[model samples]
Target: MKLYLQYFSMLVRCQMQYKFSFWMMVVGHFFMSFSLFFSIFFLFSRFGEVDGFTFPEILLCFAVVSMAFSSAECFARGFDVFPRLIKSGDLDRILLRPRSVIFQVLCSNIEFSRLGRFLQALLILIYAVLTSGFAWSFDKIIALFLMLTGGFVTFSALFILYAAFSFFTIDGLEFMNIFTDGAKEFGRYPFSVYGEGILKFLTFGIPLALFQYYPLLYLTGRSDRIGLIFLPLIGFLFLIPCYAFFRFGLRRYQSVGS
Candidate 1:
């Protein structure tokens, strides 16, 4: 933990060196996400409700997923840019460290710029909570915190999965964005609004809805199933397969030029 803090502190200092550039990147990130936020706003304006979900309910879902994703991007920025590390042989240096390879990989990069996106999501979350008409309770609040934790783990696993794939092909893969970025965009609404098929996929396959939809239903009083509130905990299990795949890929890593 101390080493992690030291590494994080170094990154903070590095980002501080170019204050203007850092602030510019933060602003750029905020606007980049603002476009998506506007799309949601326009959609809600036209339809009022989406598949039995109110605007505030959808906003809550969006806030959870967006904040989780942005937090993952912040901490797991190393995996997002793993291809560059491999290409530049920096990953080789990581392997030489007397620590777990995964740990080293995780510590490779830290993106402070993502804080802007996180702040935007947090603002949306505050708004959603205030306007969503859901009576707050202790259990409900715990569920909300669990949802955020679960979402972060799920998104972080996806980032790791993306990085693990780089071991086989040391280049950027745009297709993977369908799961990462696409989730952030389309996740503005509950997974069920996409239809039964997509909801099933998110529940059983990706388990995104486990964290976003089911718990959300309980929070919004759509369902009194206290059990559903804990469904997000299932997302932690998703990490098992992701880690297995990463282990498999690491064994196949050929050191770029070998």
Candidate 2:
């Protein structure tokens, strides 16, 4: 933890040297993310709720997913750029360090720019809490906190799994965005809105729904099972297999000749 803080401080100092570039990137991310909000806004303005969900409820769902994705991207962008590290043989340095490779990779890069989206998510979350019609309580707060944390861990695990695949291909796969970015987009609505089969697949297979749908049902009073409120914890389980897969990939890593 101390080492991570040192790395973080150094990274912040380096980013400070390029304040213009950093702020521009932050603004860029803010606008890009706001596009999704506008899409939802226009939809609600016209039709006024879809699938028995109100605009405020939809905003809450969107904020949760966006917050998770933004948080993951802020700290886990290193995994997203893993292919570049491998291609340049920079990962060799990570292997040589006494620190854990995962920690090294995590500290390799941190994107404060992504916090623009995080702030946007937070603003929406505040509004959602005020207007979503669900009375907040201690348990509800805990459930929401768990959902955000679970979302961060789940999305980070996905990035780890995606990095593993890069070991075989020696190139970054764009299609993996179908899970990461696609999940954030579709997650604007509860995955249950799609259908039972899709919901089941998200719950048990990809586990994207672990942080979104079931717990939401409980939050909105649609489900009586209090167990559902804690389902997001299962997302943490996803990290074990993902880390094991990443280790398998590490064993297979082959350096290119300079």
Candidate 3:
């Protein structure tokens, strides 16, 4: 954790060295994400609620997923760019370092610019909370916190798994975006709204629904299942297999000889 902070601070200073470019990238991300919000806004304005979910409820869902995804992209961007290390033989240098390989990779890159999207999501979250119409309670608050934490963990794990795949392909796979970026976009509505098939896939296959949909049911009072409040914790469990897969990939890695 301490080393992570040092990396965080160093990166912040380095990025801040170019304040104009940094702020412009931040603003670009903010408005780019707002476009998706507008799409939802126009949809709600035209039809006024789809699948029995109110605009504010959808906003909450969108905000949580966007925040989680953006947070992951910001911090775990190293994994997203892992193919570069393999291609350039940077992994050789990384392996020689005394630190944990995962930690070194984690420290290799961080996208503070993605905070723009996070800020946009946070603003929408504040708005949704005010207009969601459900009475807030201690349990509800805890559920919300867990949803964010779980979603962050789940997305980060996906990044790691995506990185693992690069060991075989030696190039970044775009299809994985279906789970990372696609999840953020489609998650504007509860996963349940998609269909039972996708919902089950997300729940059992990817665990996206574990943090977003099930806990959302509890937040919206659709169900009082106390268990739903804690389902997001299941997302943390996803990290184990993802890390193991990364190690498996490491074993099979043959350097590109930079």
Candidate 4:
């Protein structure tokens, strides 16, 4: 942990050296991300509700998804650019380090510009909580915290999975975005709203619904099942396969180099 902090400090100093470019990236992220919320606004203004979800309820869902994606992109940015690292052979240097390669890669880049999106999502989350007509309760608060945490880890796992795959293919894989960015965009509305098939796919296949949909049902008082409330924690399990796959890819890399 101390080593990570030291790495974080150095990265911050490097970004600070480029003040204009840094701020420009922040502002650019802010404006570009604002479009998602804007589209949601226009949609609600026209129809008043999406499939049975109130605008506020939908807003909460959107905020959670956006915040998760932004948090993942900000902290795990090195994984997002893993393809570039592999192409340039910079990944080889990290493998030689005494520390964990994941740690070194994570510390190599910190896209603080993503904080602009995170801040916007935070505001939306607060607004949804205040205006969504749900009374505050202990379980509800815990559920919200878990949703945020679970979402973060879930998205980070996706980033890791992306990085793991980059070792096999030098070309950029656009299809992977269908699961990462695509999930965030589609997640603007509740998972169930997509229909039973899509919901099943999200729930069983991707686990995105573990953080967004099931707990949301509990949050909105549709169900009081304690199991449902804690389901978001299942997201942590996703890392096991992702990490194993990464290790597998690393071995394959060694074989290719040999």
Most accurate candidate by lDDT: 3
Query: Compared to the true structure, candidate 3 yields what TM-score?
Result: 0.97
TM-score of 1: 0.96
**Model 2 Cα lDDT, one tens digit per residue, 1-258:** 998899999999999999999999888988888899999999999999878888998898899999999999899988989999899999999999998999999999888989899998998899998998788888788888888999999999999999998999999899988889899999999897899999999988989999998788878778878888898999999999999999999999897787
Cα lDDT tens digits for candidate 4, 1-258: 998899889989999999999898888888877898999999999999988888998999999999988998999999888888787777888888898888888988889988888888988999999999999799899988899899999988888899898878865578988889899889888988889999998887878999999998889888889688778888899988998998888888742252
Pull out the clashing pairs in model 4. Answer: none
Ranking of candidates on lDDT, top first: 3, 2, 1, 4
Candidate 3, backbone clash total: 0
lDDT of each: 0.89, 0.91, 0.94, 0.87
Error of 3 at 224 (Å): 0.8
The residue-by-residue lDDT of candidate 1 on 1-258, one tens digit each, is 899999899889988999999999999888888788888889989999998988888889999999999998998889889889989989889888899987877777999998899999999899999998888999999999999999999988888888888888889788888889898888888888788999999999988898999999899898899998888888889989988998998888888674
Which window of 10 residues has the lowest lDDT sum in candidate 2? 215-224
**Clash-forming residue pairs, model 1:** none
lDDT of 3 at 137: 91
Better structure of 2 and 4 per lDDT = 2
Please state the error at residue 67 of candidate 3 in Å. 0.5
**Tens digit per residue, CA lDDT, model 3, 45-144:** 9999988889999999999999999999998999999999899899999999899999989988899889899999999999999999889999999999
